[model samples]
Target: MTTPARLSAPAVATPVPWPDDSVSVLRNRPVRLGTDPASLSRFGDDDWNIRPAHRDAHTTICNLNLRVFPEPLRRQFRAVLLAALDHPQPVEPGGRQRSAEYIGIGSMPVLARGLQLFAHWMHLQGVRQIADITDHDLDVYLQHITGTTTPLRQQANTLNSVRTLWLFRDVLPASCRLAAQFPWPGRTANELVGLRTSNGENKRPRIQDDTMEALLAWSLHMVEEIGPDIRDAWQEYTLLCRGEHSSQAIYVGTAGPRLRAYVDQCRRTCTPLPGIPGPDGPRINYGHVLRLIGLDGKGAFSPAQKRWLAGQGLPVAEHSTVGVITGQIQGRPWRDTPLAIGELSGLWRRLAGALFTVVCYLSGMRPGEVLSLRRGCCDTDEATGQLVMHGHRGKGYDRAPDTPDAAEPTRPWVVVGVVHEAIALLESLHDQPHLFPAQLRVGMFRPSATHARTCSSVNRDIADFAAWVNQTFRRADGSAPIPDDPAGNLNASRFRRTLARFIVRRPRGLIAAALQYGHVDTKVTLNYAGAPDTEWLQDVAVEKLELVLEQISDDAQRLAAGEHVSGPSADEYRRRVVGSADFPGRTVISPRSAERLLGSTDPQVHHGEGMTCVWRPETAACRAARLAQGLPEPAGPDERECRSTCTNLAFTDRDITRRKQDLHDLKATASDPLAPRPLRDRAAAQAERIASLVHRHEQHRNEGAPA
Candidate 1:
C-alpha cells in the first residue's frame, strides 16, 4: 500500500504540526524514520475528524514518533494507535450532563511502550514484517510478561496492555491480524492473570467495636462544645466582611490612648483607617482581637467578663498582655478536656474536619461523594421526612464542558441525624457553600481545587483525630486512658465494608436490614463483604446446622459401641434422634440442597455461637417478643435469653461433652466429706437436671425427625 496524504483536519485546530521536534529528535536513535509509504492506508483514506478530547491523544502520537518503525510496520502501528485514540471510553451516563468519555491521557504512554515491547520481541525472534507475526508470537509475548519471577500484578498489567493494542486486529494487515485460535482467552484481566484472591477486597481492616465506641464518645463531646455558638459567630463575621465597614478591630498596645483619640477624630470627619484590610485579605488579626474580647477559646463568658472570669478561679497575671484572665498558664500538662485554643480561628477549621469524620463514618458515603458536597446540600425529604445529602458523583463523570448535560450533577443520599447536624455546623462556619472548606489563605476558607481537600486530607485528619483522642481522653473514674487500636489502620474506604460485616453478623440481619445502608441489593452486599455470593451467607448458616447434627451422630455412634454415658438425656438422645431413621448425614452439604436437607418437622436448627436452638415456635418457652407486641411471626427463643430449663434448647456434641464433665464434678462435690447437707442436695439436684436436659434434647430431636 502507498502512503496517503496528511490526515484530515481534526474537530479542533492546533497551530503546532505533527512530527515536530520530537520526531526529528528520534532520528538520532538506533532507528530512523522510514521513507513515507502509507501510514494511513490501513485506516481509511478519509479525513480524520478528531474530537476536541482526542487532541491530547494526537499530541501523544506525534511525540511518540510513529515514523521510527519500518515502512509497513509503521503503517500498521499508526492505524492501530490512531484507532484506539479515536474511540473514547464513555462514562456511565446519567444526570443532566452529557460527559465526554475518552481514553485517559496517562494510558497513551503505556500503549506506546507496549507497541515498542512487541516490536522488540518480534525483532529478537528474527521476524522482519508484521505479516509473519502469528498466534505463536503472541504466546511468546504473554510468556515474557509472565516471566518466571515477575510479580503477579505487574504481569497482569503487561498482559492487559498487549491485549488492548491487539484489539485493533481488524485494522492490521490481513496476515498479521490475530486468528480464532489466539493464545490468550478474551476473558477479564483477573481471569487471564489466574491469580487467586488478587482483588484485595478482604485486605481492608475493620475498626474494632470498642475503639469505634471510644472515638464516637470523644467526637460527640467535641461537637457539643463548639457546634452551636461558633456557627453564629462565623455567620456574623461573613456579614461584616460584605457590609461597608472596616471590620479590623484596632490593635492598641502602648499607642492605645493615641489610637482611641485618632479613631474619634476620624469618625467625626467620616474618614477611614489607612489601608483597611479587604475581605479577601483582611489586615486585621482577628485571633488577637478574639483574645482581647475574652472569647478566644470554646467556652462562654459573662457580660462583666473580667470580674466573672476572676471570680471563676481564673487568676489574672499582673503583667500579662492577653485580655482574658485565666489561671491557665502556657506551660502545663495537656489536660484531658476540650482543647484550649488561644486563637479561635483554628478551632472552627479543626471542628469542620472533626464533623467530616463523624459524617463519613455514620453515613457510609464514599470519600469522594462526601468531599464533593457543598453548602445547602443537606435537606429533609418532604415525603419521607428523611435527611438526604446532595452532591456530584465523583466516578463516571464526563470531562467535556460543552456536552448538553445537566449543569449540576446532584445526587441525594439518605443520612442519619449526626450527618445533618454536621452539615448545619459546616454551613455556619462559612458563607461560601462548601460543606468542608479549609483555610487556603487569610480570610479565604472557600472551595478550590487547591484548597478543597480530597480523601488523602480526610484520611490524615482522621488519623490525627485518633491520635488526639488517645492523648486527651481518659475514663470517667480516671482509672486508665483509652488505648489506641494496635494496628492504627483506620481509613475512610473501610467503613462501608466494616458496616456491612456488622449487619451480616447480627441476629436477623437479613437482606431487609442490608437495604438501609448502601442502596444495593443482597448480592451487592454479599460481594462487598467478600462472600462468594448471596447463597454464601445461607451456606454458612447451613454448615453450622450440619456441625450440630454431626456431633449428635458421633454421640450415638459412641453409645452404640457400648461406651459409658452419664448425661440425663444422653442415652435418650442417642436412641431417639441419633439412631432414628430421620438422622441427617455427617457429610458436607452445598447451599442448593440445604433447604431439602432439613424440613420444618425435622430438627429445628437455629445456630448461635457455641449453642443451637432446636426451637418449635408453637411451643416456644420464651415468648416475650411475640406475646407482648402482637407480631405476626412467632417469637423464637433468644439465644442469650435461653434458660437451661427451656424445652426448645438443644445442646451440641461439644456442649453435651461439657455437660458430662460438669455432672461428674457436681457428683464429686456431693460425695465430698467437706460438703454441707444443703450443698450436697443442691449439687445432686443439678446433676439430675443436666442429665434430664440432655435426654430431653434427644427426644425433641427425634420428635422433629421424620416419623
Candidate 2:
C-alpha cells in the first residue's frame, strides 16, 4: 500500500477573547471549587482542585496539572483545556454548531487527561507550538494510541480531544491555535479508531444464573437478617466511644455490683460467657462481659472478680473485645467469630455492597440513579399500596450554559417490597443524606465529606462482596456460597441486562424472577421497564426476539426428529421453521440484521405455556379484544388471551403430552365424590373437550404420516 500524504496546517484564524485564568470553568458549582477561582493561576499552579459540588465524593477532584507536560507545551495545553471548560459545545470549522448541552464540570478531568496525552506526544516530537504540528504527527499519535492495550473506547476519547483542539480553535489564543484541520475529515473519532457503532445491543455480559442466585440470596440474607445485628453493634460501639461510663469512681461504686449480679445470673442459668474464636480455641469475650454489666472500660474487672470467674470456668483475656453476633444463616450462626470493632467498617462496606446488588438487580435502576437515592426516596402509594422510588434521573438532562444548579428531575421507579427492605438497611448503615454514601464511616479523608458512592467503587464493592461471601459463608456441603461466573466480576451495569434476560426467559424456580416479577403484577413491571427514560423495554424486546428465533430453531429440530405438529397453523409453522434453517443460533447478529430477518420471515410465532402461537394478525381472535379495549394492534400474540379454538394455536408433541396429563387430572377431579357438584360438572366438561382435542391431534398426526 502507498503511504498517505502528511497532514499540513490550515490557515490561521483570528483569535477570540480569552477568559482570564482566574475564571472558573465550572459554571455555578462554586463551593466545590476548593479554592477561590480569582486566586487560581492556571499557568503558575500545578494542581487545581476543580471537582464539581454535584460530583460524588468517590470521584477524584479534577486537577489540571500542567507540570506533567513539557514546559514548552504547558501554555498550549492550558489553552486547549480552558477552551474546553469555557466553550464545551464549540463549533467545528465549516460545521454546524452542536445543539447538545454544554459539557458539565464532571467531564473536565476526562477532557484534561485526553489533552494531557496529546500534549505528551507533541512534547516527545519536539513540537512546541500547535501551529508546527503536522498531519503526519497526528496520524502517528493515533497509531501509537491504537497500538496500545488501552480499550477502544478510551482511545476514541483521546483522539476526540485532538479533534476538540481543532473544533475550539477559534476560542483559543492565536499562539495555541492549530494551523492544520483535523486530519481525518468527515470521520468520527470512533470510526477513525475502528470502534463499531452501537447497534442497540447491550454488550454487557449477563451474570450467570447460579452466581446471580447465590449473590442475591446472600445479599437478602445480609439486608434482612444480619443488618439488624450490625446496626445494634454499631449503636453499642458508638455508645462506648462517648466515654459516659468510663469513670473509675462509677465502676467502683455501681459497676462492681452489676458485674457480680451478671456473673451470678449466668452461672445460675448455666449460660456460657460469650466467646470469640482464639488461637487455642474459643475464649471469653471481655467486651460483651463489660457491656452486660454496664461497665465501659476494658480491664475494669477487679482481681477478686477475675478469680471468682476463673473458679466458675470463665476467664477474661487481656485484649479480647468481640462484640455480639446474633445473625444466622441456614439455622447456624452466620459468623463463627464475634465482630470486632475494627472489622465493622469492612463489614459495613460488604453489607452496603449486598444492598447495592439487591437494589440494582431488583429495581432495574441505573447505578448512578441508585447512588443518588436519598433517605425517604422510597414510599408506598397509599391508594395502590405499590412501592415506588423517587430519585434523580442521572442521564439525559438539558442544562443551560450559565445555570449552575441545573438539578436532575425526580423520576419514579416501581420496585418490589424487597427493595424497600434494602433501602431500609441502607438508611440504617450511615447518616449521609444519600442512601449509598461514599464512606460508611469517617476515615482518613475528610470527616465531613458527604457525597454519593462512585460507580467504580460500587463495582469494587460487588467484587469484594462475592469474594467475602465465598470466604465467609458456605453451603450445606461446605462449598463456597457464591460461585465464580465465567462472565467475570459482577458490576452495576450488568444487572439490568440480567433482569431483562430473567423477565424474558422466565426460568423455572428462579428466586430472583419470583422476587422481581411475582410480587408485582405485569402492569407494575411494565411501568418500570417501559418508562421512556430506560432502555430496559428495548432490552426485553431484543431478548424476546432472540428467544423467538431460538424457539423456531428448536421446533425445526423437533420436526426433523419425526415429532408431529398439529394445529390450524401447523403447515405454516413447519414452512416458516424449515425456511429458517439458516438461522444462526447464539451467534452474534447485528440488530439491523435481526430486524431484517424478522421482517422477511414474518413468522409472528410466540411460545406459550401449552401451545405455540403462529399468529396471523388479520385473523387473530385477540385482535377483536385489543380493538375493543382501545389498544393498538399488537405486533405479536397476546398470550393472556390465547384461546384453545383460535386458529393461531399450533400444538407440538410436548403440548399434546401436557394436554393429555391435564385431561387425566381433569377426569380424576370429575370422578371425585368429595368435590362440589358444580366443580365436578365443570371438570367433566373440560376433560371431554381436551379428550376431543387430543383425539383430533392424534388422528391428524397419523393421517399426515406415510400413506
Candidate 3:
C-alpha cells in the first residue's frame, strides 16, 4: 500500500459553546449479574438477565458459585444428580429443563432450586416456552436455598438476589452437552442450604448465655485455684465467650486447645441437631472446635480431629512460674499468621501505608521500589522525589533476543512508603550497600513454605517490632498484645499491597500514585494491587488482559519457582524486578478482555500491526456471480498453513519491486536513533512481546490470545 500524501488542511470551523457537563460518558459500563429472569432457549445480552448471543455473559454466571466454594458443592451436587436420574421435564419445551430431576424436592431442595434456576435461565436464553410452572412455583424454588426472607436477611437485598441467581446459574454445565450435567458449585451450596430448609430450625446446639457464663465463672475459679499459665488460658476462653478481640490470645497456641476442650465438654451436655444426637448427651464435630480456633474449612464444619473431644474436660488452670503460653492458642488466626506487612500496614496505618502496599503488591518489585526509590517514574520534574515503584523492564532493544518468549506478566507486588521509614531506619541500621538489602538475604535460605525468602524476612522483622511494641506497652488491664515482638512488620514486599490498598481507598491521590502507576481506574488498580479475581472475568473480550495481575501475584513464588532453572539465585529476582512491564491500557482493558482481542503471537503468520495479506482474483468464489459468474473456492486450508497462496492472483513487477524495496527500507528505518520515540518504542515492544508469546507457548503449550 502506498503511503497517502499529506496535503492541505481545511479552514477552521466556528467553535460552539460547550455544555455544562462536558464529560460525556462512554458506552463501557460493565454488565451487572442478577437473577430477575432466566432463559429457556439460551441467555441473551440483556443487562438484567442472561444473554444468548454472548457466551461470555452466559458462562460469566455459570460455574461462578463453582469458583466460590468448589469441592463441597460438587460433592453435594453429584449425589442429588445421581438420585434424580429418572425425573424428567419436557426436553423439547422451548429447549428448557436441562432436566426436571434437577428440580426434585426430595431430600435435597438446593439441587431442586438449581434445576429451577437452570430452567429459568434457559427461558432467559430466548426460547419463549409455555409455562410448565407459574411464577409462584419460581418463588417456592427461590425460598429453597437462601433461608426464607427473614427481615434481617431481607436487608441484604443484593446478596439475596445474587443468592437466587447463583442457583439459576448452577445448572449450566461446566462443559456439558446436556445441561443437567452442569458442574456448577451452586449445586453443592444449594445442598448445604438444603439443611436449613428440611429442619426448619437451627439444628446445631449452641451454648446459651447463662450456660456460657457458668462455664466462664467455673473456668476462672479453676484457674485461680490452679496455675498462672492455665489461668491465662481460662481468661482467653472467657474472652472468646464474651466475643472480645481476644484474637490476641491466639499468640499462645495452647489456649485454643485448652478452651476447645472445655467447650467440647459443655457441648456433650446440650441438645443436638434432630436425628443426629450428641455423642453422650451432645456430641460436637470437628467443625465447631475449629471455628473456636478461627480455622474455617470449605463449607463443612467439625471440631477437627476424627472424634469429638471425648468425655473428659480440661483440668483447672495451674500456675506456672515461667508465664509462657504455647501450642494451640499461640497459633490461632493462622490466616493472619505471618501477618503480611502489606496487610498490617494497610489496616492499622490509617490506610496510608496501603498505597505503598499497592505498588509492591502489584509489581513485586525488589526493596528498591520502596527503600531505594527515587521520584523518576511518577515525576518528570522531581528527579529525587518520592518513588512510585512503577518498574517494568521493557523488551529487548535492537535485535530481538533468541531466547524463549516470556509472556507479558502483570505486577503482583508494588510498594511505596512502608519502606520509607524502613529506608530511613536502614540508613541508621546498616551502611549503604543497596540499603535494607533483603535480596542479599534471599540467597541464604532454601525456599520454604514457612518463610518466603524475599518478602517474609522483612515482614518477620516488622512483626517482631510490632509484637515488641504491644508487649512493652501493656493495656490498662495489664495484658500484653502483639506489635510487641520487637520484629516490626515492615519488609521487602511491603511496597506493593500497601500501595494498592491505598490506591483503592484513596484513588484521588492517583495522579500522585500514578507518579508510580499512572492514572488508571481504581477497579483495575485494585486487581493490580492483588484484590481477588471475583469480578471482571466474563467481561468484553477487550478487558480480559487485566487478569495478568492476578496470575502473577497469585503465584509469584510458584511462577518464580517453576521458572527457576536452578535454585533461584539473587540475580534472577533482580531481573524479574527490572524486566517486568506494567500492562498498558489497564483502565479500559481487563485480563479476559485482553486475551480475546490479542491472539497469541506466532511467527507462522505476520501479526500485530505489521500483518499483510493479498486477495486472489482467480479464485472461483471471487469470480462468482459476475451476473451468475463462475466462482472458485478460496484455495484451501492447506494454503493457510503458509504456502504460495498469493500466486492465485497475478503479481505485477512493480508489486514485487515495491515489496522488496519496502522490506529494505523498513530494515534500515528500524535502526534510526532519531526516529519518533513511540515508533522505536513500539517496535521494541512488539519484539519483546513476540519473545514473551513464544516463551508462553513453550511453557503453557496452550497460549491463547494476549488475554
Give candidate 1 regions above 4 Å deviation. Answer: 1-144, 148-150, 168-194, 197-201, 227-353, 390-404, 407-413, 431-434, 437-452, 476-482, 501-707
> What TM-score would you give candidate 3 relative to the actual structure?
0.19
**TM-score per candidate:** 0.49, 0.77, 0.19
Off by over 4 Å in 3: 1-380, 383-421, 438-453, 475-502, 506-707
Best-to-worst ranking by lDDT = 2, 1, 3
Task: Return the lDDT, model 1, position 179.
Answer: 40
Best by TM-score: 2
lDDT of residue 638 for candidate 2: 68
Mind giving the per-residue lDDT tens digits that candidate 1 earns over 1-707? 45222222112222212222222221211111111222222233222212222111112122355655554455565555564564543222122224444454335556665676676676677776655766667667777766647667656666665665545454344544434233365354556667664322234566676666566655555565545544554444444333322343443333334334444554576643322135553232333233343234423333454243223332222121211221121333223232222223544554655787677766656565576566688787798787777665444424221122324335566667877877777766665434664443345222141134556666676666666555554566863343456656667776654555454434332222222323333323432222223432443334334444554565457545644432223334444554443553544335445535543323333434333455556555455544556743433345534555555554555656677788889999889889999999999998898877566555655665411
Candidate 3, residue 226: Cα displacement in angstroms equals 39
> Could you tell which candidate, 1 or 2, scores higher by TM-score?
2
Models, CA RMSD each: 15.0, 6.0, 30.3
lDDT of 3 by residue, 184-255 (tens): 223333343443234221122222323222322322322222223333443343344344534434433453
Residue 620 Cα positional deviation in candidate 2, in Å, after optimal superposition = 3.9
Give the winner by TM-score: 1 or 3.
Answer: 1
Kindly state the number of residue pairs that clash in model 2: 4
Question: Which pairs clash inside model 2?
Answer: 7-135, 9-180, 10-179, 10-180
